[model samples]
Target: MRPVRVRTVAAAVAGLALLSGCGSAGGLESTGEAPSAVGPARLWPDLPPASAAPYDYGEGETARIPGITVPGDDVHRLDPVTVAQAGLKARTKRDSGLDELPDATVRQIRDCRTAPGDCPVLTPYYFDLTGDGRDELVIGVRLPERQLAVRAYRADEGVLTRIMSTVDAVISVELAGRDLVLRAPSVISGYEYRTAWSWDDRQQAMLATRDEILRVPERRGERTAPTPTAPAPEGSRPAPSETPTA
Candidate 1:
């Protein structure tokens, strides 16, 4: 597989040292003595994944994803979603009612049921996948039939142009540095399917970069899963509370 062309991710942190009250920092530290193992599978945007990729923590205690070189702090700075939303074609369409219970969001879902293209965009995640000093907007929208619409947008000339889009039964959408991850329940017991995307500078778009069907044994009642995960943290909505929360 072609190694992803990018730079050292730690530059963002190192750049922070130049700021006041900030100093040198550390990169991901490996827990094991041996070098990390690499997953063999390679995925592409034009193809469906044959199987899940194996996990390797790499040089860090946490699993280190290869080919994901991004400015850590930059992702937090670019409010890509708001920039995209500002240029949305459907931004003119307004949402009615408030505190009306589940019926509110449910009604919005019904209105856009037949019109999958018109579903309400819930929250968005931002990351500088393009390496152009600008962040891309990864927005997931809620639709009827328990489906989701995930898309990425780039602001060009003060206009948010739709760069990519996909639909699935998604549980969550998240932004992690250069990788935009999504999760959904699977039919297999003790396992859940996850599809992840990374910004490809060459493609000038967000591509399905990683796919994993994980067998997580730590959580209780793996048979049952709950709500989705947001890009902000473990438990939070994707909607920006203040037009861009870092």
Candidate 2:
């Protein structure tokens, strides 16, 4: 016990002695080496890893940010993302996203199809998916969870209304003639799920005529009948010799 006490005191004293010469209270500390004892060498390092961009605040050199934008009116326009989000929320009956969006991200939906100027809405495809001569708007909306929503809209009397919407993950949508072909990735390695949608007059909507998980079997060839080899040429063929040929 006595030796242990002495050893503990000695260790404490040694630690204090070692730290005594470290530095004084005035020793300023910072990330970069002190420029002159008060501050760092430079507040920020040269930007752009390779080379610094020339910052000349001339007439147009200064960046001018436009005014605030928000989701606005839409008569014949639909953003794929916003529509997809709405579709997801409608289908799940739950908030698809949190309300914690940055002020910079808050945007008004603007009708980009008719209202000139540059709009944030993505371009939509037009096809008569409803069997009317007038083309209907078809859009593939990208959502979270790698989900996608294929929606079709029709504009009648200055009103754009969504008529059909289907959402799924890992999906690919295509227009085959008048039919809409939708394919989703299947768990099975070499197969996928496919659904062909065609507009039905009586149903007044797009209905899937074919829906099935199909295997796109790989094209492999097996030799059912081995290729025959040509017999040795008569002239090149060696004659059957009774004895060893000279």
lDDT of 1 by residue, 110-175 (tens): 555466465476656766766678776566656567877666666554444445555667777766
Ten residues in sequence with the least summed lDDT for candidate 2: 57-66
What CA root-mean-square deviation does each model show from the true structure? 23.7, 24.0
lDDT of candidate 2 over 170-221, digit per residue (tens): 4678889888898998999778999887776664556667889998766667
TM-score of each: 0.43, 0.42
Candidate 1 Cα outliers beyond 4 Å, as residue runs: 1-119, 220-246
Q: Clashing residue pairs, candidate 2?
A: 70-107, 70-108, 70-109, 71-107, 71-108, 71-109, 72-108, 72-109
Candidate 2 has what TM-score?
0.42
Residue 192 local lDDT, model 1: 78
Clashes of each: 0, 8
Q: Provide the global lDDT of candidate 1 against the true structure.
A: 0.54
lDDT of 1 at 217: 67
